[model samples]
Target: SAVISQKPSRDICQRGTSLTIQCQVDSQVTMMFWYRQQPGQSLTLIATANQGSEATYESGFVIDKFPISRPNLTFSTLTVSNMSPEDSSIYLCSVEIGLHYGYTFGSGTRLTVV
Candidate 1:
């Protein structure tokens, strides 16, 4: 299993402002994903981070709104740009350990937009 350290456990920002959340994995991983959980809602897949290449975003999510950077095998960053009140949610990063071990998630960054 890998340990994920996500920074800024929580934060409050004004509307239209941007916030960048970082995720650091203890071990190298091949599959890393970013997800968003809105209040009282299920987790929605945001994008897949590929090392040495651009991230692959899911439907309804564009790279302009949520830019992901995967600089290496163990680290990545997701930025919520021009946020609004509707964007307030818990952002989490996950890594798949394997078929048997399953996936591991970060503590999550709780963002509140005013």
Candidate 2:
């Protein structure tokens, strides 16, 4: 099991501003993923962070917008660049221990853009 922590539990930003959220894990995980949950919507996978390599982003996400950094095995960060009100959502960092263990999610960083 891994315990994940995220910073800035909630934030309100003006349009065109950006925020960077930090994710820390207690133990090294094989797969670290980032997700976004819009209001009343399901969680959408943003990217998968692989150690010693560039992050693999899912569809509808680009590196220029949501840049991810995995400096080491147990730490990662996501920067939401060029923010817009449409981008407001709960961004969560998650990790899967195994197929049976399912995924564990961070409390999430609730971002609101005005």
Candidate 3:
């Protein structure tokens, strides 16, 4: 099983400012997934970060707005740029922890844009 450590559990930022949240997994995961959960909506896959390739983002997300980095197998980072009130959401990282079990998520990073 992999344990994930995510930082900046919550933040309140100015409208134009940006926030970078980091996720560190205990073990190497072939792929790490980033998701956004809005106030009243379901989780949307933001991107998938792999060790040696560019991240693949979802339909509505672009690299310019939601850049992701996976320097290695166990670490990754996601930055929300030019944030606005509408961007407020819970950002989480997930990876399959075991064969029998499913994905396990880190403590989400909750952002509030003002």
Candidate 4:
């Protein structure tokens, strides 16, 4: 199993600004994913990060708005760009530990855009 550390547990930001969230895994992983959970809602898949290649984003999520970087097998980052009040949500990072072990998720970064 792999342990993940996500930065800036929570933040309050201006509507027009951007924020970058970082996810670091203790062990190397082949599949890492980013998700966003709105208030009182289910988790939504934002993107998938594979080492040495560009991230693949889900519908309604674009590279320009939610840029991702997977520099290696153990680290990745997600940036919420040109943020708006509607963008306020809980951002999380997850990794598939294995088929048997299931998945592990970060503590989550709560962003509130005013």
Candidate 3 lDDT tens digits, 1-114? 679999989999999898999999999899999999998889999999999999998999999999999999999999999999999999999998668879999999999999
Q: How well does model 1 score by local distance difference test?
A: 0.95
The candidate, 2 or 4, that scores higher on lDDT is: 4
Q: What is the lDDT of residue 63 in candidate 2?
A: 97
- The TM-score, computed over Cα atoms with residue i paired to residue i, of candidate 2 is 0.96
Q: What is the lDDT of residue 35 in candidate 1?
A: 98
**What are the per-residue Cα lDDT tens digits for candidate 1 across 1-114?**
889999889999999999999999999997789999998899999999999888999999999999999988999999999999999999999999878988899999999999
Q: So what's the TM-score on candidate 4?
A: 0.97
State the lDDT of candidate 2 residue by residue for 1-114, as single tens digits: 679998879999988878999989999886799999999999999999988899999999999999999989898999999899999999999998867978999999999999
Deviation of model 3 at 67, angstroms: 0.5
What's model 3's overall lDDT? 0.94
The window of 10 residues in a row where model 4 has the poorest summed lDDT is 96-105
For all predicted structures, in order, the TM-scores are: 0.97, 0.96, 0.96, 0.97
- TM-score, prediction 1: 0.97
Model 2: how far is 21 from its true place, Å? 0.8
